[model samples]
Target: MVYPREELYPREVFDPRDVVDPREELDPRGMVDPPKVVDPCNAVDPRGAFDPRSVVDQPKVVDWYNAVDPREGVGSRDVVDPREVFDPRDVVDPREELDPHGKMKVVIGRLQVVFSRAMLFTLGLVFAHSLVDAAVLSILITHLTAEWNEYSLWKAAIVVNVQEGTLAVAHIVFILLSDVWTGPYKMLLCSAAISALGLSLFQVENVVSFYGPLVLVTLSQAGIVVTLRPFFDDQVMSAAGQSTAETQHWTSIVWWKCITLLAAASAAFGLSRINPFGTRSLVSAIIMGSALFWFLLGTKFYSFDEATGSPLRDAAHVMYIAAVTKRNVEYPRTPNQLFQNSSGHVKIPPHVSWLRCLDKAAVVMPQDQEKPGHICTVEQVLGAKSLLKMLPIWMTFLTFSTVSATGSTFFLEEAASIDEDFNFLTFIFWQRLSSFVVTFACGWALEELGRKMKVEQRMILVRMGMGMGCCVACCVAAWINARHWRLVDSMTVSRLVPQYVLLGVMEGLSIEGLDNFFITQVPELTVRYGPAFEECVLGIGKFLTAICIYILTLLWRWFGEDVYSSRLDKYYLMLVVLSSLNLIIYCLVACWYGDWRFPIPAEDDDIETANHNPVDEAVQEILLQHEKDSLPLLEQKAGQDTQTLRSRSFTRPSSPMVAHRRFYSMRS
Candidate 1:
């Protein structure tokens, strides 16, 4: 429970000029009078201090002491004096010994703490952006199909699918830029500005202008979403200083996201109902502009990761090197024979056999020695292999994403047609709320279970599997609801609740699982691309949904201009079958994944070790000193009360200080 002082307050918070040292603040003689100073050489040997003869006739320190002492009673060993345990060399002053490099490391660590705390501002930005984003997207389809536009349902669906697809592609482009060139903060500012501009353009009446603005909005939103989470994560990890458990840090991220989702849902419910859709767009623009302003206010405190050169480029180099060397070079017989740097700056994992051919990329050829760029490091090759290993698991989630696309499109259409008085916004509100609750609960439960069971690595797969199973259930519920709506004339929007709730639950589970897996499993240098890859996968799923709808319409009358004539129940039935198959495939992939653990980079371990609290070392020194000072007093009294000590019971002290203090008081 006693945390180090550095953990509570970073070193940057204290300045020598601002702090008044007690030694300099007051006269030493006035504070502790000269008369009160004890001279050890001239002092009396107060009874039972060190002289064994003084306590020859006194009772021993405690009765029954011999019962626990190994030398006195139970299996006898050499009688080792407690005083011998205190070694002067063992009690080091951590501050006094630290070199210039160590001092700089301490300063950097404190600065990292200051930067990490700035994630509070990042969370506020997430809430603001997500609020406006959800409000705009929730009403977009309805706005297109309004009386003024008179747009066909198919036309609206195409616009929505196109926006979704654009978002997917934008995620990749923006994330690459953030990682390789611009950095996240600059990317965030640019995206926010573009989003505001796009939202403002929605006021234009020309139909031809719609698609252009929609693409702008989708691209900007993708950049914001892809950049912000990773930015927040960087701060959290730095703030943790590699000292806290990884599960706890991720749990905090999940909980913060749930809060952002809840806020966005509330904003959507309230702001999407602003009568005219143009007014809603204008309101979203104002909110986004305000968020951008608020984000800039924290610019000084925010931590920005320096843009590393592209992982894709490194991957390409690895492949090119492997191909060029294929005919002439042979794979190294041992991993150490490969081209690792003498300095060991990069921590490469043991060579994996999955992509054995790529090992040639790392072979130290005669020419490669002179041109280091011609050969790839083993780390780069393994990073590419890790991505390939994750491919099958990523493919399994496409069906889940396809099923999710229905909530905003077909599900809303179904609700709108059921009853003229039904509040579809309220349905969306409840659905968002359900997902937020499930996400919060699942994150907490999984963290606790993983900590207790020591199975933190496997929990990500379990969460993904649960979400996939829920996707199938969601589709089944949709089919049932659609069938009941067709058979009965009095059905209300309430009939769609089950499917909506299941959709929310599925999202809460699967999305977090995918995010955690990607972030943790990928090489540290390329982690920014993880979430972007997830968004790209979901976008592909939306395209697949569009493709399925197109094929179905071509073969039979599955969809029409409105919800009433469309055989949506059949479409839902098809999703149920596809999702069921996806779930089975996911299980096989999970089994194949087995016990492979992501290797934490060696630098992180060094940081964790170096970040230990110096205050803890100082405290330990004081405790050891106390033990040393008290031992002779106890030894002097031990022989006098040997009979009395045998009859009295003594419980072990909770701490070394307690034991030392108890005997010191006895000597007094």
Candidate 2:
């Protein structure tokens, strides 16, 4: 409901006379004198006293006594009599406070402005969605063995390992086919439907029915990650206008993740107590259903990026063109020497010098006279170059992915072998929540440091460092595992908190680093592709982990046959060495790394002035073209009064369209 000015300030309701009188007194001209005074309360008609709907709600109440007269002689009581004042809180409607514009606004104290109702609803759904995901990750295999007696622990490990491999494949397939998905709404609906069907079919008493649904479950989980996550990232980036908003954006994501983990942890614990009904999966299905409903309800309010066809197609085309245009060519003297035009041009970006061979794609050949853009635009070539550049950095994250998969798979298995005397509460408290606590605590400090440094790339580097630290911590935890193989009887799951906490920190920093880096660096046309590419990277990592596990499983003689008789600590020690080596490689890559052309805050002119790269110069040329092309077409002729359109054509191609046109132009 609309708030009324009078209701907000019942004492001094809006008065035309008061407004006029104050201005007249404050006016230095002194052109008028106070004629008379009329009590507005008595003069108002009973039927037309105040139309509350017509008034705007003022956030700040005006104290007329102090505000009306700036002169020191005017005391607090001079302009507004003490008797006329009333408590605004008494008359104000709290509903108006929540929604002044008659639209729902979700507020958690100060965060109301940034976190809209729809966003909060979406985040809630995310939390519930993650409950299902994490529970699957943390509890599914263990549940299969412990409660259902489907298989032995070692066999269960194999089943779980296979499931992760399946999950990675599912993610890769979804990403490749993401172009067909349309938008997040459809994906959410699809995920919910698949999850419901899978969970329902999971109850059936047959191996075919059970494992088949598990595959569907894996697909559904992929849907959630590929769809929901990008949508949220879009929202956060859209809303992050100021530094506070940026911090809040990351903070909200971390908080959502924490809440999701906590919910998942709770669901995992609840699995034991909920009896024969399979309530954990049931609740998960229910949450998925609820999330779908919420997503559908909020669809209208949700924002989507301008769909720029499939990134897969773009990448493929670039590769095809680069391959077709291959030549034993020398580098051009200058970038502009290759493709020079009024509207567009190609550039051999210096940053991409590591792969000088790819630069051949942008090399204009005499064959171009026969087929103009059959090769590709300079930008398209650069886009392809970007993908090549990303591969090395992507591989560095493989070790991290391996570490993460091990933590969830091996650690959960370790928890199962621990003392049965410890209640679920103890395990949940120690194993589940400690990571969140450390991440939440450390995430704030790290983010604050990033803000102080004012370099987002530095934060990315720091985040990777944290990931390396997690590797170290994992190594230590593994050493402890080697030393104390069966401490579960006394200390129980609580002793594993160190490893969990470290992994949690690792996830908070490294995974988020990957996400933020991509979002910030990737061009708008390929922005949607960033998340999918990330999924692909992590998928490869998971696949690598699966391979390692399978190899380890095959060589049971080396790593030991099972958890009880296993020298798992030695395996952990191996990972420690691998991680250390990986860190050294990553550091070297990081040292050699040059950042993509990132958008800087308008205030920071130093980066632009200090060191300009070839890509930046190319982008600047396009921006200048944009400025030139966008000149106003309608203007009054020099001596004529009437407006007339300019002679210039207004059909200039957009950035992506231009690139596409350039590609085909060469073919023609």
Candidate 3:
């Protein structure tokens, strides 16, 4: 390996800054040939020198590991083969060297920070809303009779039920309107203002005035629930960052449920004790006002996406196009024969053959040739098809939701009869607590399990488990109700606690599971509005519960006269049988359900395709032409400046020849 005197280190073109001995030389027959030194002034490209013959030449070394120095003026004997000179890869595997466990620790630590921050801000809103809810639902019922002498228990129940029914309708309205209302914060602000006004109006002494405030409060509450739930879910998504979207989405939901639990606990355990209506109203108004203020403070930081047009309209269009095109065109055996939208964004229709009837929307009729984009895109058809597929599952859950509604009504009555000391608020507290603990725990457990299974399978399993819980809860309730009917005096709140706990377990899993399923399964454009849909489902459930209650009221003979005397055990038993049947049906449906065939492409891959796509190029050129047409005056005024700016903005060349030309041109 010893170098000869002449070849070790050549002095020609050698820089003083380089540390090499000029007297030493390298052997001519070493691993590589002697280095050729070129003058910086005479070089064709100063970036690096390469042999002209190297274009078609094989590499000098048999292996990359045995290659000599790539740099100039360092011969083979002076510089050892790179493989001989220490290789870090030889000693350290990157996965082991970098502390793989530390990466997980970092992610978990970041999640904790995001969770804490989101909880701190959102928990305040939760507290404020919970106060308003308790005041409106619980205190107002007793307050109208205790203070104003305006209502009987029957009247109060009727009024409350009416208010809730109105709210449910309003929730559905807002969910449908979400596509038109791009600014959720505007709704948030309006909800707060209306709620504050409603709370303040309650201070009035007149009985006739109550209805005005009641209507405003009910609408405001619905607006807040529809707007804020989705808004907060979006907020958590933002804080979570993109890498862990699924985990963060689930975590955010869990945190939100926990906050609701805290709110209920606050109301049931603390706010219910405040007997004075005016005082309670004032507190609610202040908290609501504070929530509004807090929301406004963070307005600049919030990132809101513009709403795409309504999914309902898209679904409608899909149906219309399919019907119109059905008779004119022959169905293509291969999906590629059908009209595929140039934009990869819209799901290709014919690919999903299961929904063959809907695929008619993708047929390009003569009318479509004359006017492109008038016909429905494949994406619209896919979205509509997905809705059709999920309908059975939604209906099953809708039936299950009836059990939840029973808790607030008959279940509350059962608890009250058991212990007068336990009261309405205490029952709400226990219900909230059970929901919080069970939901948060189950969500966390499922999240861990999700890593091992596909998301689709995990969601189904969670729902099935929830269905089992509901079945158990119904069985318990039926037994308790039977005991109450037979003895009439042995019921206790402590005895009803287990039922609440079980119901909580059922609801927690079902609600979270459903939310997760829809958030991912629904149209990508509507992902941000997922929580609004959840509210709609809940609203429908409550509405159905109202209907059920009304039907029960009609059958007075079997139900006795009042809460204590009513033979509600039969109703409990009925639900048990109904839910058992529903459970069986759900199992069959879950087993049958198939995932959406048109999986949305990843955002990064879509961007890359768009950059290179010929169709995208044409569209971009059209956009650029439009821009030029719109800015003619500006272009004329700053013609030279604009040209110079455009030229400067062109991506710089990376090659040596281009760099050299640019360098000389700049010097000139």
Candidate 4:
């Protein structure tokens, strides 16, 4: 079955050395060295031949050029030659930790290293997943009513809405429970299992079919958001190095890009007519199944542990709670229980090198550490005394809950008109292309803008932009009603594009940045909250929208259509005006926004100066014990050489671990 090796690459027929040489006299340092070409079997590849099993297919990538030493050269190694030294990474080693589970994992294939495939898959799954529902509403509902005589919007919404609500509550409960007692792996595994179960449930048929899987669908999404945030962030952080303060920043950018790409792909696939099976069943099955595969299975290799696995990292976080607060570790537990306390003063082991331990003690929280919180001093609250620690928590709730929430409203609002004249696929194009174009443009704008400003400034701008954008959207609606007041049919592509485009622009400006802000400001444990935060906002926004919609409904009934339509412009304008007002308030609030203790580096030089690991309170507690009680014990526990403190006890706490003595970071 294998094709002849000759067909793949004809080594005997081609010699790259003739075209390019590593030992070119013009070359200074040999980075441009041509790959060393050996005979068909690689008798002597100056770069050393990688084994066949190393690559996926063992691609017979023959070295196109052989390393040649010139008689007149200033010494072979002394002179840089491409043949002498081409980075052999192109020839991958399968044994070189190709598996995601490997302790030292390379960025899965090269492109994944560059773009993050795991996250790409996750984001794409969700983005594409929406298409199924959109179609369900667009086609299935229409078909059901016309053919089966069984379609009810209120019923359908109730089913989905209730299921979603139940799912959200269960998800929060699960997250809280897991945060305290479970390892990140356990939660991810459980989530994956639950997601699979939920998807399978969608296959069931009933009079309440769509409504039936509501709880399952909701739970599945919660699991995905909770698990995915850390899974993606960890990969990005490990590969990125010390300046990973904004690992989520990179994650958000990739996430948005993938959303755009998926939207584009869905547009391309648009309403398939391949077999015309039960459209509703097929759509539900696909969505649930994909969610299972992506949020649960495909990411088996990608989880939170790798990102936030170190004991040192966890201990530091727990210590942050202790160091800042005067309270003992006996505090009540929350959903996230990385926080712990110690009342007794246990002796510090003498052999421990406080400074050396302090060095590595600086590692960021592993991805598995979800919803990390900082123990802020009373002053850290920035005068929002009542809202200090609470702001981040409530804000996160508002953001994450909104993911699928606003989504429903937005898609519903856009029920796409289709003419029976054209083929089904053409209609798909309109919906998809437009959606993707909007998503992509927004991502691009945010990334481009992110690079220009300080992260703190960026944070403030995003919130203001988002609140204002919402207002703008409302206004746009108002304008649409105003300009075309008399003619309902007068609204054409031209008018629609302006409104749609503006909404899209606002989406780009606000959403990604808002997501990024949440991720950046919190500790590593709380990084998982990024998506949760965004989704919450969406949830809240949807609820708010729902309430508004209800109020609108009441107004419509009381005032009648003529009166309501007449006031539509006023309502829209009111939204715009309110948004402008909100923007002002948001900017003012953001002025007080500060960086997480560690934020992403702003420049190249920061790469080094930024923390490899810093000895913050978390580092101190995990590294050593209280000075008063532990000193005698620690002094006794000193090394055989009586020199460094690193040779001592690494055990459960029995003492107050002071900051400086805890981490030998000074020496580190």
Which candidate ranks first by lDDT, i.e. highest? 1
- Give the 10-residue window scoring lowest on summed lDDT in candidate 2: 659-668
lDDT by candidate, in order shown: 0.64, 0.56, 0.55, 0.39
Compared to the true structure, candidate 4 yields what TM-score? 0.52
By TM-score, the better pick of 3 and 4 is 3
The per-residue C-alpha lDDT of model 2 at residue 431 equals 43
Tens digit of lDDT per residue, candidate 3, span 622-643?
3333232211111224443221
* Candidate topping TM-score: 1
Query: Higher lDDT: candidate 1 or 3?
Result: 1
* Candidate 1 to truth, TM: 0.69
Q: Report the error of model 1 at residue 225, Å.
A: 1.2
lDDT of 4 by residue, 587-615 (tens): 55565454332222222221122222232
Error of 3 at 230 (Å): 3.4
Candidate 1 — which residues are off by over 4 angstroms? 1-120, 147-150, 234-255, 323-337, 341-354, 600-668
Candidate 2: where is the Cα deviation over 4 Å?
A: 1-113, 147-154, 233-255, 258-262, 268-272, 299-301, 305-308, 327-330, 340-347, 366-373, 421-441, 451-456, 486-491, 559-561, 594-668
lDDT of 1 by residue, 220-334 (tens): 8888877776676655554444443433244344535565666656665577557576787888888788878888877776766777545566666677878775546764543
lDDT per residue for candidate 2 within 158-218, as digits (tens), equals 6676676566556656644544545556666687689767865666666456788888888
Please list the residue runs of candidate 4 whose C-alpha ends up more than 4 Å from where it truly belongs after superposition.
1-112, 115-171, 177-210, 233-256, 272-278, 283-407, 410-467, 470-474, 482-486, 489-499, 555-574, 592-668
